[model samples]
Target: MSNRPYIVGNWKMHGTRAMLAEARAIDRAAERLIKVEVALAPPSTLIHACRKEANLIGIGAQDCHPADGGAHTGDISAAMLKDAGAGFTIVGHSERRADHGETNVLVKQKAEAAIEAGMGAIVCVGETEEDRDAGKAEATVGEQLKASLPEGEAAAANVTVAYEPVWAIGTGRTPTPEDIAIMHRNIRAQLVEVYGEAGQEIRILYGGSVKPENAVELLSADDVGGALVGGASLTAESFLGIIIAAAGDDAE
Candidate 1:
């Protein structure tokens, strides 16, 4: 992947087949910006359709079960996501942890499943506002990364880590550029400790209120390999703005 900035849009629970137009538009724009890698993790319902509609931008699923197939009832497995044309899946997102009660062990299993099914995994880890206030933000995120990442070869090969502060997500708030730089540096150190030289190849992304206006500054931060965008990614115009920011940074 050349370590190009990997800008991924997580549509969350939004998007239907109707939004495929925006996805196609994003894909078209991605084609022109070959210096950056762009991807979208849409709701499961549109994964196949979006994959079918786009040829450039990577298509991914918002979540997936650890098991291949079973009586999990309503839960889609990693294999099914791959079958649906997803090249990747995002696991352990803060929303899944809060709303679905997903534990770190389970997130690790899901990430392993994604690797097993031949898909990339974007594993998320973050701290809450309270944790930040209590001066535990760094330790909390470091612990989550240790617990949530897959083991052995999968750890460095298939996973990308995203740090999204729970309070900042969808709240129109973000860590200062210095704070983001510090966090990413901390994450890079942990990854290197665990995976050795291969860890340097692992992409660390920053999420939470990543808009086009601020994308350049954030993407320029030390060790910030890319972004895991939220609302701003809903529209191609908006998402393309971030991608352009990344491309510009890469050029510089």
Candidate 2:
């Protein structure tokens, strides 16, 4: 929303109390790297700890239950995440979609829930390698984005779109810049179609196997507002490298 590149780290199923030190260091570096917007989604157990350590960087949740309160066991809701100091939550990530069989409708509900709970939601939508090979990548992602995005004007303000190809995630395989640019352009068109001009303000983040080496080139891709880093974000050293890359782009 601030026009600063939104670089987020998804620490998925990682981090303990000991990892707070790295979070602190990342936060400190983020304070200095004012040109870029940095955030981290640590495990739920460490959300509060990371929040306490983060002064400039944002602390967020990897996922959240759509319900505010319920009998559901081992599920944290958007309200609970906000209470724990998470300013935002990632919904519809590839892992959740594949591992938990999450549907587009359910993902949309989750995004709406997060917005209702006064938190931001990063809605993820991407296709698999098979979809790409079949020439259905854009079509697949377009449908997912349309179904997964929350409704209303508030969505334009509270929602961020993350594109993470299923096959590329954790595989050290990445699409070419031309491919990423094309996908992002399609995504942007979809957003504009849904949210109108306000959609232009929503940041579209590129994810999956994002690291220091590829940060600059990836961020330079058309409509790539930032990145949703995975393993590269576990340590301050690697994560900061990506953040610095975003900052460098912002400077230009």
Candidate 3:
């Protein structure tokens, strides 16, 4: 429905300069990848260096401040990231939403900030295991989506929605195909409500415990445009496999 499905690798706090070897490898391996829009968010320290590498993949930051100019010490605004050649940014990642106490208001601000800086924002929303076990998964995720997502009127087309269940993220756990379907459907429904006709254009990605081995199947699911990969995305080969799988049907 959108221009192209995008697959994003969120390196989180896991990369160092040595990881550049992997980034380069991924770029080289992805030489033939055209059906999917591939990008990665490496550690902030490596953003500039990653940008200077091969040109196949998109480069983005983990996060940014809401304001262009700010008195907040240690805060990097969207303008700075844009100047550094970032084409995307991550907002409301589960860790930030939970650990750092980031609120939906804050996440919304950061998304707006990304638009201001000339970049796309990957906004994340999910539910904890407790919520899932209680059959409250949809309810929890719905609330988060409502607060975390900007109405189509509020945010531009540069927004990407990621459905990452906190229960499954990095815990070596994953949702069943049925569960994934329901959550994504709910997310899409909410987007339609907020964005109206424009909601069909939002790229909805499934994240959490995504690996090369399981990638293709995940990408093929209904409404699953791509993945917001974690652990498996650290390496170029592994990450590339996922991309290759996402582009499986398009193979010619």
Candidate 4:
């Protein structure tokens, strides 16, 4: 996946059957933009629908339960997501961390479950605004990532790390390129410490307020392998712009 940007759209709680049109459009564009890796993690209800519409683009789930089969109510398991045609799943997203009170240990279990189900896991880690203001941004995120990541060498193959500042999501704010670079570099160092040489192969993506207008610059940051987009991904026009930016950046 070297030189190839993995641009993913996290539609969150949004999207219904009506949104399949946008998914189709994104898939068609992804087919043309072979230089970039494009994927979408729609709401669980739409995962099958999006997969049916997607050929080139990957279809994934927003989250998954760690248990393969459980008495847990209202939770979809990683195996279920795989059966629904999802190639990957996002775990430990900031919203999940905050709204659901997900801890680093639980996130790691979720990631391990995804890997066990034969799917990729994008484990998210980020610091809150307070942590950043207190000069603990790097330390906070680093610890979260270390604990949240799945164990074993398989992690280097099936896991991807996404850094999304909690305060930036949907707020239209973004860290400057230098900040992004610094955070990514710190994350890289941690990865290397944990996984040795194989860690360098793991993709560390930037998220939070990622739009087409800034995709190129954000993705150009050192060790920024791609992006985890939010609102802008709900539309083909806007999402395609970011994908195009990634393709252009790959060419460089």
Q: What is the lDDT of residue 21 in candidate 3?
A: 87
Assess each prediction's global lDDT (C-alpha) against the native. 0.92, 0.92, 0.85, 0.92
Could you tell me every candidate's TM-score relative to the true structure? Answer: 0.97, 0.97, 0.94, 0.97
**Tens digit of lDDT per residue, candidate 1, span 1-252?**
356899999999898788999999999878889899999999999999998999998999988999989889899999999999999999999999999999999999999999999999999999999999999999999999989988866668888999999998998899998998999889989988988888888899999999999998888888898999999999999998999989994533
* Ten-residue region with minimum lDDT total, candidate 2: 243-252
lDDT of 4: 0.92
lDDT of 4 at 168: 89
Predicted candidate 4 versus true structure: per-residue lDDT over 111-157, tens digit per residue: 99999999999999999999999999999999998899899657878
Residue 54 local lDDT, model 4: 87
Off by over 4 Å in 3: 151-154, 249-252
Which runs in model 1 stand beyond 4 Å of their true positions? 249-252
Please list all clashing residue pairs in model 3, or write none if there are none.
none
RMSD of each: 1.5, 1.4, 1.6, 1.5
Model 2 RMSD in Å is 1.4
lDDT of 3 by residue, 11-42 (tens): 99998899998888877766676777888899
Ranking by lDDT: 4, 2, 1, 3
Q: What is candidate 3's TM-score against the reference?
A: 0.94
State the weakest 10-residue window (summed lDDT) of model 3.
148-157
Q: How many residue pairs clash in each candidate at the backbone level?
A: 0, 0, 0, 0
lDDT of 1: 0.92
